[model samples]
Target: MQTPPPKSNCKSILTCLLVFLFFQVFTGTLDAQEWAKKMFATLEHDFGTVAKDSMQEFRFEFTNLYKEELHISAVRASCGCTIPTAEQDIVKTFEKGTILATYNTKAFAGARGATVTVTFDKPYFAEVQLQVNGFIRTDLAFSPASLAFGEFSLTDKPRMEFNVSHAGNTDWMITDVRSKNAYYEVEIIERTQLVNQVGYKMAVQLKGNIPVGYLQDDLIIVTNDVANQEIKLPVSGKVSAPVTLSPSSLLLGITSPETEINKRLILRADEPFTIESLTCDYPGVTFRTGSEAKKIHIVPVTFNAGLSPQKIQATITAKVNLNGEIILKCPLSATVE
Candidate 1:
């Protein structure tokens, strides 16, 4: 290699160093400014005292005061029981927006306090938390009232368990367990622990006959915990019934430079049930279930595959046998190519 160049001049080196330092300082100031601007509002109201069975909501509003377009990173509630709804668009800059939060007073009776935090983009990108308070009925409340088991594969049995905390601090009893649908069932094993806290081990099982589409049902747990009537907990999800595809999976048998092909999958459930919901994890995937079969009793699941990847998996949920007391579940599977 050639010899290294001669050393630089002291003045030139100093000038280069100053230039770099200037850029660093300028950028730092710009960043600091971006974090300083904001205009916000919230439902920040109090309901004071309320009954046990009634449900209510609290909404908040916010806006961008920056000269440039503003963006909101996220808006989250302190707890899931307090549902959060925010602006639909993310890249909204210097525009007006709103965030809505609905607190389910279901299991929250008596005096209660909760908060929601919102984050935005600017120089001073910071999180602002808002609070809402009210009295909730402590007669009977399901801690972690809502159960959302996201997306699961056909063979996967997703599960979660929560506690029942009383505000009145009174000891109550769960009398009976039942479901509106038959395909799925739940079991409650009574046990006492955690110092004065009492409840049961509730398990919901879906049968293999579950169709591919949407599945939903409610578990009506009759409890002396409440006055007279039984409280209900909803269990819901989308199901991907059984499916079959030829030469499964994408990019498997491709030999030509630009090969074009088409395929389909037949999806159907073994028993009758209504598809409560249908969801997909992948963008290239699609599904079709019941419109005609409103109240599915024993409907055939048909998955029509079209240029979809082979060897894909999905799960569907539904409510079956809308009567009597029983514990059961519906599970299904499908193949792609």
Candidate 2:
């Protein structure tokens, strides 16, 4: 038989256990911090001098050197001036990921800075803080900051003009305009060159015969200022079809074999026109439209599923009389079982 320990001795033992647990928790937190430091390539970024209203981004790359998978649960910036994003959260052993931090130059002007904190919850709990610093000069300004072309016909050429001014140096000249898009034509004219101010008139033209879809592009204005050489202007608009189709793609969902699926489509135009003909490439797909010409017309389309399970894909072409023969296409698809 063994003698039992005294109550005081038991209490001492329990206290020692608690202290050891505390030590483990504290050391774990320290180890996590150390791991984060070793994983990141760099912890700080200085953007030097950046142009106002220009979009800028920095990538903080890291690799999971440990054998275990590393998960980044959350990435957040201290202020709205900076937005942080992770390319991927889970990184396997020896894999890499990037933390993208974008600075909002439009909302934040004249000396902006923020701290981004990245938190990891898996493999081990850890947190890494990154610092970014930059200065935005107030000397350059744009009247509209951005360009919007609104809605335009594909056959019609559209043009827009805006002004850029510099209050710092009078000799600040726009040396060149650069755009990768072949459809855009840009022209810059010096509006005024005073003792303490300089101004330029910028004209952007969208050529006719551009592809029918949305237009989102940027024009880079290269200037004589060495510190801030390139300035970006955003251009956005939609190039609309003269003859538009609502629900451009007809979806019949899922249907049983030999069943019929009926759907309605709306065809519209800015001006009144007549739909000369409508046809579908698929064997069992058909459409019917009214004979009268109008700005808007509704057509009822039907799809007949054969006696088998199959996937359907077809193009519906509409010939319309608007100035000339305008051909509009709508895609049709369905699954039959």
Candidate 3:
């Protein structure tokens, strides 16, 4: 053996090792900010030219791809022309959230833009900026601003009408109306021309072929104005199933054999509907419903664990009246301990 190192030198070497490890961890945290940026698919949206007093909205959607919970610590907008909001605060892994940027149509007009900053504190601190800009014409406006269809069934063919007026120009005319959505059809039903003013009455109809989900689209109107060629109208509605089910899938966590669980299955429709029958092939699973025809029915289901512990996977089917017979099915899952 030649010699052993001194105690002070050994201590200094150990300190260097600790510092190297800490630097690695700190840099890793800084790199995670890039992960937050990766969640957004796009960073900017241009609303172009829109009619004043009309609804202009855009959603900056982001999904959490990490294992940790993604969170929005704060949300802000650079100007009052664009109002920003978070759909929720904390989003779990693989789930989606939206940063809604809504233009302030009632109060402000003319060209406007905003920067929406979203701050995340969890899964590492990060900041994301989203941009939106639009030219809101004061001379052009919609009487109702937007087409809101609310809720309706697939069999119901609904039509709504609104008027668009342009001031300060007598020669202004709507050349044509256009829509790229197959489920919704839009057209100019009437036109009124006056000295220094022009107007149009437009109608939108929801077709029967639309599936059950939220309906959202923009109807573009081509105008004769050389500077601004198109005006957009936002349309929103929901095409609901005659017999709708809630909770998506039943998630009954681990339980004991002596447990008797009571759960609810909510059924709703756009119109008054009656459930002709409810069936389930799962052993020890039973259900009961009301007999009256109504817009909603609450079906109470009871689950008995029997005498042993096991996993349960089953499906519940319901028959309803929507001009004829319509079937709705839902999945049920549970584990007994």
Give the per-residue lDDT of model 1 (tens digit) for 1-337.
Answer: 8976556676788899999999998887666544432355543766443335444544465544333555567777776556767755353333456676665676555557777777755434556667877655554456455444555545555556755444433355666767656655556655454545555656666664554444544556676643444555555567542332221222222223223333332323344334444443433334454643333233333343445544323333333232211112222223333
TM-score of 1: 0.34
- lDDT, residue 110, candidate 3: 86
Quote each prediction's TM-score. Answer: 0.34, 0.46, 0.66
* TM-score pick, better of 1 and 2: 2
For model 2 the TM-score comes to 0.46
- Candidate 2 C-alpha lDDT tens digits along 105-131: 777886778999999988888999999
Top lDDT model: 3
lDDT of candidate 3 over 125-224, digit per residue (tens):
8888899998889999897888888898777879999999999788888887777767777788888989888988888888776656667777888998
Q: Considering TM-score, where higher is better, how would the candidates rank from best to worst?
A: 3, 2, 1
Which scores higher on lDDT, 1 or 2? 2
| C-alpha lDDT of residue 41 in model 3 | 77
lDDT of each: 0.50, 0.80, 0.82
